[model samples]
Target chain A: MAKHEHKLEIFRGYLKFKSNVQKIWGVLIFLSIVTAIEVALGILKPPILMNYFLGLKLINWIFIILTIVKAYYITWDFMHVRDEKPFLKNTIILPLLILIPFLLFILLWEGSYIFDVMLDGLKEWDFDIY
Target chain B: MQASTLTKTKQKTWGGGGVKPLDAAYGKLMMWFFIVSDALTFSGFLVAYGFSRFKNIDSWPIADEVFHHFPFLHGVDAPMYYVALMTFILIFSSVTMVLAVDAGHNNDKNRVAFYMLLTIIGGAVFVGSQAWEWKNFIKGEYGAVEIQNGEILQFYDIKKDKRIPIDDFAVLQSQERVTHDDNVGIWYQSEAKLPEITLSEVMEGFKTNSAITVRVEELNDKGQKIILSREDAENKLSSATRVVKGANLIRNEYGNPLFADFFFFITGFHGFHVFSGVVINIIIFINVLLGTYERRGHYDMVEKVGLYWHFVDLVWVFVFTFFYLV
Candidate 1:
């Protein structure tokens, strides 16, 4: 049997806790802050952030980025992935990292193509069948 | 001499495979694999949802308008508020689950049991909220008329800038209409419940009410639903075929039927996961109370179930983003 070590440091070791309970509260506060920001942005939906950037609203980009940050904290801190061996961490993350983007690309591209065919390219086709 | 030969043969067959590659217990590693596979399954469903949304981008239902109901706030428009609260509950449960695991690490059985109880409560609350949401979605607020071309036309009052239910303006008809029950229709084929108001009644009411305007599903340059002109509204209403009161797998008062379909499938699947997680947590909590892990000298069972609980929370983050926020 091997002795397992728990990583008690967070925020790049800036907020080191002597006890696990303290660390748990720290991560909870951090996650709550991030979620509050996300909810606030969702409710407000400011026009400035609604401006288009990279084919999406800037606010949308903000939401996505903030979500990723929250996910990372949940995985690394709450799930204790940070304490796992590097091989284990990579084993879990690598497959999803590769697959999600590939799936997104295919779905978005094909959807747009179908939209064009239905709405613009084939206007002569009658859609008014009861 | 015989023992040495047996050892050699055993080594040859087994290849010294007992070493844990990543220092993770076998159960924990298997849980990780399951989580990965499950994550892919969810991603597949969500990507499919993305495809359908993109295909009908212009007419897609705005999430804010569709999910506006909040508990105890009758007739109030609180978009994304309840869902945000649900997300927080799930995340907080994940926190408690990890805390339970942490307690297990310290060999503190009491703390582990307490935290596990909290986690289960959180999961129950979240599942209940989701069911309520589904109910609201199925029993829609403002009903729409489905035209001949399969497009939905919802009504809005110009002065209020809000959706008005058909019940508010629809004129009651004296003619009797019966729903097609199993006996009325074919024995094996039965029809869904009919809407409260008939199409002719809706048209008559619309003709009389000049302030009510039709909002088409199509989005304008600003990404808002387009309001048809009075003449266009009259023209479109002339083609009305059926009245859709709410959402189902087949049709929805909302613009795209596919949106409702995807909503049911994806969220239903995720809800199932949360449900199963709660059951598993309860089982593990009972085992902890029975001192099963304490007697075994390690609480690896709690840690493994914690992995599952956290994965559920992780999937929800994506769901919240894709379905509600983005």
Candidate 2:
């Protein structure tokens, strides 16, 4: 068995907790607030955020970014990934960083291409066998 | 990694190894990798959803429309509220789980057990909420008509500016309608159970109705489903095949079958994770009550499951964003 000490600061050290239990409560409130914002945006669906950016809605981008931010807190704080050694941190995250973005790019690009092909309404939308 | 810590083993063969290479116990490290792999699998499902949705962008069902029914608020237009509540419940469970880990770190037996109990209750509640969501999805509220080309055409009231269920217009009678079972189909190709209202009934009902209009799955420039004129609705209804009541693997009252498929698969998979997390927590809770970790001088098991519980929460955030909010 080894002794473990948790770094009791979050928000890039802007917020600090004297105890682990307090930090856990703080995170729960923060996460609830973020989710509330997301739900509110979803319900209201402001016209300004409906504008498109890079073929996606600006509001959608905000939602995805907020989701990522929530994921970060859940992983780094709740899962204690922040306290892990640099080797462990890089190994865990670097693979996901490479793989997730690559897959998203390839699949979304191909999906859009398929959409274009289907839009043309040509019966034969298949690519060449080569 | 420091040079001083990198001591070369005197053995002839190099076995690149650290007892806790991932900066935790081997068990926790293995759990981390398991989570990473599971995350990839979930991402694959979601990306596949994105692919199908993009390909059918003009006709993909609006998630808010499909998932509006909250637990007791029947027929109420409460979109994203229930799922939001489920999200908060799951996140609060994750908080309790981490608190359990922190309590275990202090070797506080009573607190660890208490938090673990709360965490388990929270997880069970979240799973229950998801089951309710699936029930609502499977038993769709606003029934639609499926035409010759497999596109769903929903009915709307111009005055109300909202969708109307098939039962509102289509007359229900004691007709001898048989289920489309294996015996009834050509070449024994079984189909879903027969819907309540037939195509003729729907068409006739539409003719009698004055305010009802047909909403095509195709989206207009404003990203709203196109509501066809009465004459055009009749024109499209000429090719109507059957009345779709609810969602199954084959049929969906929602716009696209693919949308239903992804909804079931992604959320179903996440719900399974929450279920297993609760089971695992229960097992650990029992062990904590027995003072297993206290006897062993540490509480790494609590910490490992905390990681898993949090991962479940993390996945839900993404699922909520992509499935509902997006």
Candidate 3:
């Protein structure tokens, strides 16, 4: 009985150590490789892919997504949120989720308005701007 | 009964030290909250920029042509390469930061310190590169013709249908300069100088010289610049070029003023953030080397600072996209 207890304790200790190492290395490797891939894509900026998107360039989307991925990993893993409870994570992320879209929408709406003004009116102005 | 009551009272006392809300180490949670606020600030700036961009859709200068400088090779229309390099530097710095965090986890103090140093250096280099970019932007390109009202009028000869330089025409300075300064008079309003050559110079030149062409901002049915043949440009230039120069609101030799405004404000703001980030990173770097966090048996200090550094990188990603890519 004593011997069995000792073996179980040893196994648990080893597993705990291994898990810690894996968690640390897993995030590090993932971030490094992803960053490398982004750099490569940016350098290449292949026009074939760029043209496929409807007036939206591939380079822009790639940078945005890659940036999001990096932010997600840094916040979740390196920042040790993986160990955090769900409620805690929600507290941190919830406000951002609500605000980001609202802000973007306002910008887009207002931006479109400004574009219309410049295009529709300014171009037709007869005043001589020598 | 009294003894049991005393023990219950002791147990009932609030155990305030037990697991705090959010279950995060204090430093990490605070860092996260800080990032949230910082993100909001950047979003505001970007949204405002977007609003401006949308407002001037037709005349909004194309981004590609404006940032066409390639280092060591002048006039080699290389766009997006330097910004691409800056992006790589930031991302690499982010990698080093993660490595430092990893080293901290393994209790590899030396490795953590080394990686942190590299990150700090990377940030410094990125800021320096940004400064260089600003220098190029501030120093105007192919100086344009200035008017009395500080308005700029760019010359596009109708005969040749190309943008001409102020030097192309024989310019004469105004003799009756508007001098109101205390030195010139008791009430000094500095005289505004108008371009002597004006648009008519090109027009008149083209009327005599048949090779000039004029290209206006208005696009044709094919979406190309509406070009006026020598005869049409000569006719129009003679009539319209007579108007006194207002402000160069349209495209000019130094590129576009709108571009200058955006370039100065957006990149300048971003550079300010970077400069401040570098300063803060240096403070933390010194702290790390001094064994401030090491003495605590927890490198949480480094991790907190890492979050700020990464946040800087994150903002740059957006700036790079809007400033260069978009």
Candidate 4:
């Protein structure tokens, strides 16, 4: 009888941990707080809020970091990545890790070229009064 | 042959449990993998958008002026408020979806149904709001002059300190010189009505009115016209009346052409996702109601759809930031 009761307790706990409304509520509240902070920072544009400890513009860096955090949580909790195995997780993230950086690099390179072109054309880009 | 391939991929366990190391139940694993790939796609688009924005760093249109609309408040320059509200709505719906998933785990059918209904409503409302936003943008508020060079030049009333009508600048209306192939010689076409107040008329007005300032695209930032110093405005007005061919790529009367392009592509893309998401959600909602999961003894399907719904919300968060706020 005692063994049976212990087994029942473990099962109940497993069910609760696997899908608990309260835990989901906690995640929701935390996400809301983070979103509010982002909104406040975006609107206030606080001076001296550096993203890097040394030289980087803190606002842009912070935004990127916060976005990554949100992405991580959405994957882990909402998409249940924690329940997934190491091999499966690696399979999914490996491609993204390579592709996203490559895409950003290309965009930056092309964008700089366009910027130079626009700057050079400034002499003729000006308006004509007729 | 397919059976052999499946068995070959399914590795035998040391203890004879027969479960693979990388094995996860289909829905949960697929959802995670799909989200990962979708995230990469969104990041690519946004990074490209950022690249374009950086290229035009000096003269990018201000987010405040472009998306300056609020519900039930006309002509009130409220920026980011509506989009902010939409963000909150999406997040709230996400909360409800997660809760529904939780309820499903506990086998609480009633709670799951209620939350699912709420999520559907939130999605529908978001789609409606987006339609309204598109309508306001497509039917522009202030009318502008369509120059011969395919460029739009906005108007300003010198005396009223407001946008003037193209009809107000009319020295002579355009007479129809050619007819279309469809209506050739069938009916006499009338001339296009010209602005009532000509450039010379505007120049005369600017000279007399001390407060009047004429802003030109080439002269203004982002190629948008604004009232400037009275003397400078009058000087611009005194130039020759013959309008030149203005380029539409740089700047135009409807804010900026680039802004229009981004607005259509990004929002249209996001809206397409929302539409498809809703359709998918409806399908799954029906499945849930029919007790398919109840008989299956697992509510994993609900969890999968919840992931998709949350993803739709996630993309909106970035859209709200870049499109409306930044």
Candidate 5:
């Protein structure tokens, strides 16, 4: 059987745990705080954040950033990726880093082009296809 | 199986292929790979949703208005509250699952069993709540009229700033309603269930109600739905064809049928994931009770399933952000 090791610390050693039980609580609290902030922001939706930034709402960017933060904590702490070997981490994450952006770019561009076609081209040509 | 013979074979097979490259057990590595692929699949669905949303930006339904129902609070406007509660439930389950894995690492069978049971209960609750939400969404609160151009026209009380349900204003008529069934219709050409109110009844009611106005799905520059004047409202209502009650694949009381389509598909797919996760947790819970992991001297199986549970929770974080928050 392979040897087992548990990562006993999180938050860059700001909060260290002597046991896995304590570590679990620490990560849980961190995740809860993040989620609370997200819900509050969603409810408030302040006017400043409602302004557009980079073609999207500023509030949307905040949500996306906070979501990524939550994902990181869940993966690293809850899923025990912190204890995994470097090779294992790279093997799993590298492919996603490459493929996700490519897929997003292609799909979003194609969708907008379709939108344009539906808006302008359809009006001009008037195909009977519903 | 001598060591010397094994070493000789390993040396010959492409620079010692017999060893595990990343020092991870076969199962854990495979679970990680599966998670990555599954993440991509979910991303595809969400991006497609984003595309359709972008396409119909002006006419997209406001999610807050669509999902305003709470469990006990009928007629109260509680936007995103239930969904937030559901998110918390799922996240709490993920916590319990990680605690179970932690207990497993320590070889504490009782704690593992307890936490695993809690995780299962949490998952079940989330699934049930999702079903309730789907029910409310499908049986829409206020019905809308489908214009000839496939646009939806909802009613609003100008003074109250509230939507008026069709039942409240629509006068019931004695006209005999016929539902197209397979027995009466042509073979294999059955029609969907008819809406509760007819278009003429709705138009007549609107004519009598002086305070009611029509709200279209299109958003104005202020980011609010465009409410037509009494004269324009009458003009728009003249083009009404079908009376839509709730949401389905073809039409919805909410604007843009595609919004409801993506809502059903994405959330339904996620609900299916949560359902399967609960079943898998139950199986693992049974094994824990049987002392299977104790016999093995390690609880790696529990840890692998924990990874999946955490992934489900992670995906919900994104889904909640996109579907409700943003």
Candidate 6:
């Protein structure tokens, strides 16, 4: 089979590379910067982020979002999902987009509910079964 | 005769027809499917981790506190830095792998082999770093005491504002202790290896060191473990049952056993993936050096392996955030 031309722009055509290698490095730089920000935020843990957002630390939410950003670049650029047919791309990504969050929501929600019951209920865990 | 030609070209009717919908070869498509399924499995593990963390939210160990070590930086509090470095290594390897695939597309055999070699080295270093991290975790830092109620209590110097290892202040009791080996005890009734410090020894040391306070597993609203008042700490010390030094499948000095359990399972699973990816990269590297793809008229195999390598990196990004950052 013949090799096809690779689309070399990222971030909605804002950043364009002359060749496939250049695009790969460009994505690498973006990912590294994102990871640096995550590490910095984690280490510094600026006092402002100590506040809560939707029952989780704002810093944690920031980390989670940045992680997703990194995941996007890895999948789109490195895995060439960006170059795949739209139908193929959607088929691979959409199922996960729907399923993972649903799973997380149900499990985490239940977990916290149990936490509340334990906190409000009569007995303490105190690491003891009896 | 016409049918023979079609068979030789591997052509079939449309829909079984007109250009593959995925526009990818069967092998590459199968890899993608495998990655999707594998991704789901990892998500299940991580979500279970999150579930456990939330259930024990009051006393769960903080990520930074537990994984705060760097190589040769003994006593230095380097939180997230080591893991961040590991992330960079993995990401750099992924970049090299993609470059190899790009070079393969150009049929530049030498460049493809060189990049493949770099990818393999990067992956190996990542695996080694993970092993080191696991070792440090198994050999814990500040040992804690498990109370009769099951909660763990760690020692901290209020003046110094740092954790002190149990060895530092554990004054040995006057009485001698013995390991219950099969030879010394009733046959088949031997015991596990004895802990470095006994409950009485820890309590005695606590009594002698006035500055050291007991930090309970439960946390306050500020998200820090509640350090008991001096009198309360003394009272709590009476309940000490055993001295827990390091993490294991059964005990975790850090805080909850679940914390250590999840850390091991998730990172261990991810490390396994990285190790396998390195192995696969080595095999593919040999193929490139031998010009297998060159004779095949394409480097689709290199591209397929690149996809797998990148998927490994993607999983690590999530693991790093959840396991170390969050």
List the candidate 1 regions with Cα displacement exceeding 4 Å: A1-3, A126-130, B1-18, B183-189
Model 6 spans > 4 angstroms off = A123-130, B1-19, B183-186
The candidate with the higher lDDT, 5 or 6, is: 6
The residue ranges of model 3 lying beyond 4 angstroms of the native Cα positions read: A1-84, A117-130, B1-19, B145-258
* lDDT value, residue B230 of candidate 2: 83
Q: B83-134, model 1: which lDDT tens digit per residue?
A: 9999999989988998898888888899999999999999999999999999
The digit string of per-residue lDDT tens for model 2 on A1-101 reads 46667888999889999987788788888988888899999999999999999999999999999999899989888998878898988888988889988
Model 3: lDDT of residue A111: 78
Q: After superposing candidate 4, which stretches have Cα over 4 Å from the reference?
A: A1-19, A46-58, A121-130, B1-21, B143-210, B214-254
True contacts preserved, each candidate?
Answer: 0.83, 0.87, 0.53, 0.45, 0.69, 0.85
Ordered from best to worst DockQ, the candidate numbers read 6, 1, 2, 5, 4, 3
lDDT per residue (tens digit) for residues B1-326 in model 6: 11111233665422322335467776677798999999999999999999988899999887788888988888888998999999999999999999998888898999999999999999999999999999989988889998887889999888898788888888897657787778765576788888878878888888899999989988898888898888998888787789998899888899888888988999999899999999988998998888777866677789889999999999999999888888
Under CAPRI classification, how is model 1 graded? medium
Q: Distance (Å) between predicted and true CA of B258, model 6?
A: 0.5
- Each model's DockQ score: 0.62, 0.59, 0.30, 0.30, 0.57, 0.68
Per-prediction TM-score, please? 0.93, 0.91, 0.70, 0.72, 0.91, 0.93
Taking the tens digit of each residue's C-alpha lDDT, what string does model 3 give over B1-326? 11111132354323234444565555567678888898888878777777676655444555554466767978676777777778778767877886787666665688888988899889899988888776665443433443343333344655454555444553344355343445675565555444455554444454554544555444453324455565655444443523332223342344335655666677777788778877877887786787755654556567677878877887887787677665
Estimate the lDDT of model 2: 0.85
Better of 2 and 4 by lDDT: 2
Every candidate's TM-score, chain A alone: 0.89, 0.92, 0.72, 0.69, 0.84, 0.92
Q: What lDDT score is found at residue A121 in candidate 2? A: 59
**For each predicted model, how many residue pairs clash, with residues at least 3 apart or on different chains?**
0, 0, 21, 11, 0, 4
Which candidate gets the maximum DockQ versus the true structure?
A: 6
Q: Across residues B24-83, which tens digit of lDDT does each residue of candidate 5 receive? A: 655677789899999999998998888888787777898888898889898888888899
The per-residue C-alpha lDDT of model 4 at residue A19 equals 32
lDDT, each prediction: 0.87, 0.85, 0.61, 0.63, 0.85, 0.87
Q: Per-prediction RMSD in angstroms?
A: 4.8, 5.7, 9.2, 8.0, 4.8, 3.6
Model 2 C-alpha lDDT per residue in residues B1-326, reported as the tens digit of each score: 11112124433222235444655676777788899999999899989888888888888888888888887786788988889989988898888889889888888999999999999999999999998888888888878898898888999888898788888888655677677677765788776656667877787788888789999999888789999888888888888998888888888998888888888899999999999999999999999998777866677789889989999999999999999988
Worst 10 residues of 2 chain B by lDDT: B1-10
lDDT of 6 by residue, A6-108 (tens): 8889989999999999999899899989998998898888999999999899999999999998899899889988889998999899999999999999999
Residue B285 shift from truth in candidate 3, angstroms:
1.4
